[model samples]
Target: MFFVDTVEVPGLGNRSYLAGGRTAAVVIDPPRDIDRVIAAAAQRGVRISHVVETHVHNDYVSGGHELARITGAAYVVPAAAPVSYERLAVTDGDVLPVDAGIALRAVATPGHTPHHTAYVLEEGGEAVAVFTGGSLLIGTVGRPDLVEPRLTAALARAQHASAHRLAAELPDRTAVLPTHGFGSLCAAGAVPTDASGEPTTIGEQAAVNEALVKDVDTFVADLLAGLDDIPAYYAHMGPLNSGGATPVDLTPPAVADADEIAARLAAGEWVVDLRSRVAFAAGHVAGSYNIEAGEGPGGQLALLLAWLIPWGKPVTLLAESPEQLAKAQRELVRVGIDRPAAAATGTPEEWVRDGERPATLARAVFADLVELPASAILLDVRRATERASAGYVEGSRHIPLHELRSRIREIPLGVPVWVHCAGGLRASLAASLLASAGHEVVAIDDSFDNAPFVNTPAADRC
Candidate 1:
């Protein structure tokens, strides 16, 4: 019997899979944190025999090398990736036996990247599943623009062809599992889900995937038009993955005293407070920035911080406990934000014991908008597509969170800014950014669904 297990990286909105027969298992597109994959294999009483990558990932660091090293498995990658490390380079029509009655066949499926590949899992000579990676996602295909701006149009067209090829070549019931499209930035937009809320099969996708049904030209245009701002850290991910990123070191960082943290803050280093937005809003180091530690809709701490923080800037983490600091460190290292400059764990009161007062930001709910002064401005920090579909508050100045740092100057200096996003998580991060920039800001830390919007010209709402 053959079985498959999904390991979800919710912070980046991606999934890695472990599949195998009776004696051995193979890991597909494992995350930088390989411990989970190892644990899954151990639980199933199987040894991981192969670690496979679909492409050079652009979103998070890959753990293929580490997993292969630990398990004595063959590290398999597409022949086209310009990788510096040694591994088994595969191409189209390559088949490798993984275990008794189980084998993986490589299928050339470019579009998400120039050299993307998909792996078909065959059991007893029958195709049972295809790990489509970023090529053929749940209800959509991976965005082709992550590699280069010049290749986007051509690759978008290729994406259409790739999806059709998969549908025609594979059995209709072949299970289609993708590494992206579950809120990952790699997707063009939200992929529609089935009524059961599970990933649909190739046959279901052929009937409903928008990119597969449309002409190549139409699909390319739509895909390109729907793309949003690529995360800043994405530019650095490919190189790290290709060159073999160093193994993540999860050793707890050296704890710093309040004075040391203060000195670092004075030196213009980022002092990130990893507590709840509510706890942060109540009291925090005057110059600290609050980006909550654990899971949230906005994104994971590692990916979110990697995208938001300017590259190469020294960061110091502040959490409420040693465990929180350790958790944040593990996530941060996965995205190449390895080894924070320093770390400290304590509450605002403990850090401010030197007679210094902690900083605070005013929080507002959706209903509080009515009480704001007329001179205050509303700022919508959601993606362009989200604002367009949901109809944002009329007359609100739009600046997606990813683009907020560069476009901060566009916001008026003297006026109070009321900021919001799809949920309160993004708004909290934005509010802290605005506060750090010396602006009077109130975070609408409430669901946008509950917020009121003026019924005005559709153009203004969008």
Candidate 2:
């Protein structure tokens, strides 16, 4: 009998798969940290026979090459993916046997990337499951714009065709396993769960996926309309994945004392506090940005820090414990932020220098906005798409959270800056950023849905 197992990287909103007969298996689209994949194989009593990548991913670095090297397995890549590594370059219709009756068949499904491919797994000469990767996600498809601005329109059309092709060719019961759309920015639109809380099959996809239901023209238009800003860090990911990205080093980073922390902060380096938003607001070393690293499945540390921080700047991670620091390291590596220049663990009391008090902020809800003086400047740091759809206070100035650091100069100084996002997490991060920049700040730690002006003229919006 054969079984398929998932290795989920919740932080990145992606899944790697291990599937095989009792004695052997193949790993599909693994994350940079391969230890989880190895442990998963060990638990199932299977020796890995192959490591495969569906595309040169733009969301995270691939662990395929390193996983294959460690297991002495054949690494498989799409025929058109340009890479320096030696691999079995698969074309459409090539079948890779996985011992006994299980095997993987390649199908060209390029849209997420120019060379993207999907793999169909068959048992006893019948298709059972297909790894759709970014091409065909849960309810939406991978955004085609990540590759190049010029190629976006064409790729959107291609994505529509690819989704239809898979639905047409596969049986109703064929399981559809995708790599994105589970809260990953790679998705072209919002993802919707089925009655089972998953878009589990080709039949389910046909019933709801826009690419399957709409004509190619309508699908492309709808997709382009819903596209969000690409994460700034995504530009580095494709090349890292395709150009032989080195395996990550997970050893604890060098410990930073208060002196080194102060030095780094003085030199304009990033000193990120990885504690919870609540704890971080109560107290933290002066000038440190709070990202709250251990947000689990819903965390945005990898996306936010990589997008907002000045690229390639040295970073020092500070957390409440050694374990949290290590977990944050793992999350960073998945997105190709390979190393933390230094790290520190302990409370704000331990992080701050002698004769200095820990920095603190006021965490307020939307109700508190009415109490602020008219001179208070409301800063909405949500994505443009969110502001357009969800509405915002009329006079608030806009700066996306990703662009806030670089655009800090544009925001007027010496004013009470009340910052907000769709939800509070980003606002907390933005609040810390504005505070670090010497502005008096308050984080609106409440949902936008709860805003008093949501339906009034104050929030009448696109």
**Candidate 1 positional error at 258, Å:** 1.3
Candidate 1, 126: how far from true, in Å? 0.7
**C-alpha TM-score for every candidate:** 0.95, 0.96
Top candidate (TM-score): 2
Reference-based lDDT, each prediction: 0.87, 0.88
lDDT of 2 by residue, 8-94 (tens): 776677888999998899999999999999999999999999898999998888988888998999999998998988999999999
- lDDT (tens digit, per residue) of candidate 1 on 115-184: 9999999999889999999999877899999998899988888889989999999999999999987778
User: Candidate 1: lDDT of 157?
Assistant: 85
